[model samples]
Target: MQTPTPSPGQAVLAQVLAMLQPLVVWLLRSGVGYTELTAALKPVFLEAARAELARIGGKQTDSAVSLLSGVHRKDVRAFGQTARAVDVRAQLGKPTPASQVMTRWLASDWPDSLPFSGLERSFEALARAVSKDMHPRALLLELVRLGVVLEEEGQVRLCRQAFVPNPSLEESRRLLAGSVADHIEAGVHNLSASDGKTYLEQSVFADGLSPASVQQLEQLANSLWRDVLAAMVQAAVPLCEQDEPAGGNQRIRLGMFCLSAPMELNAPNNNPPDGDGDAPHAKDTR
Candidate 1:
């Protein structure tokens, strides 16, 4: 009775499925309604469907070719074009015209500090580019429904800023803390510790945890910390991407100390006779 091993493709698919499963579960737990879920799942499901269709078609499977054979030919084609447009914009290091228009409106002189009216026009333009028959208002509404946008003082704006490419140390620590808070709020109570050191120890060195679980948690923490550092650097220092690494490393190390000191002091191993006198006290003035 030997267990059969999965092929490389199957192994990759399994990891993807595992990652996606938690997200799906979280969505269901958050009380997302059927209609909202359907709309949200549309792009993902369609992409998977198209991939599967091509897989079945052997080497001759072009998504563009297979898309035209389907009833929703126009939609598939439009999606492909929009994806290309987004890629080109990213490569050019500039926002799409719609993004620029929206940003200008955000920075404009509306009676309210936030500009919702301008966002509506930008959303319309974005929707039109996606599908000629698609209603911009509906698309915007859908985004709102999905909790990706917020309405304030008659102005619609992003619920959160886009990811910053690289971050400073202080920013990294803040982001990591924020991510921990978010996870706790979302019922991932396992990692909730009074201090950063305890949290890291529990997350990293806890007994009986699987290697896979440890790896996943480490990756999540690293990603969250990186995002925080990047945002802080962008806001406070605005360094070029090439100039970010040293600052980012310095900040992250500082953040680790800020978070870990309290936990280390509280641990049973504290006040060991062999401890180095030169080591900085947790409360020592910098």
Candidate 2:
């Protein structure tokens, strides 16, 4: 006897589970159990159903949503009665005043170290250029807190070329969530696209590499990204300014990620292990 091929939905579910493994690990670390996750998922399912219905020009009645979402009609009705939360994309994608200031400084090719306040080429001028609504002092404090800049003797210096936040900070988790969400959204859109359009979703995969090779590749990738980042920022700033007066509603995020791990993790064993496997663990460089 031979096993039958799984249906498309079943096959996709398996793939999704594989992709979700890291998320599950994070959830466990954060103490979010099954019950909490399930409870949170109900609202998300309902929202997705509503969006799908709108996309297909279908009537968005409670029964229709329930039928599509597998959520109970009562729950759907209750959900509709409550105010919807702010869109996650908006919350995640909108850069802070501090971020805008940092981007401006980086793109302008200004000195990395600038006086906090002065007549010419000061940090305050950069912050004020990004937005006058927020005081420069407040923005500086935020940048310092995120470990992106340093302040000593009234001079502010860029500490990191990139806005890499400390992993322990809440702001770091928020950024991680935003980047992961956009990356997955692009992948999903490519998979389901019906108009022959596709987002850029591609990667290079390799194995059987020694640790030294991995390290060398990692350095190469970082150098490549820095060049790409500077070019994109320089090109994008003027285009954004041109679009703003025209009431543009679009935003874009370009990102790259690299992961290298022990080959065993990539190729899981079919049989259960009585103890942890023999693979050496790799420290997370991110």
Highest lDDT: give the candidate number.
2
Candidate 2 segments exceeding 4 Å error: 81-86, 106-108, 161-163, 265-286
lDDT of 1 by residue, 118-143 (tens): 66455454446444565656656655
The Cα RMSD of model 2 versus the native structure comes to 5.4
Q: For all the candidates, what are their Cα RMSDs to the real structure? A: 17.4, 5.4
Clashing pairs in 2: none
**Candidate 1 vs. true structure, TM-score:** 0.27
Q: Estimate, for each residue in 221-243, the C-alpha lDDT of model 2 and write its tens digit.
A: 98888777778888988898799
TM-score for each predicted model, relative to the true structure = 0.27, 0.85
lDDT of 2: 0.81
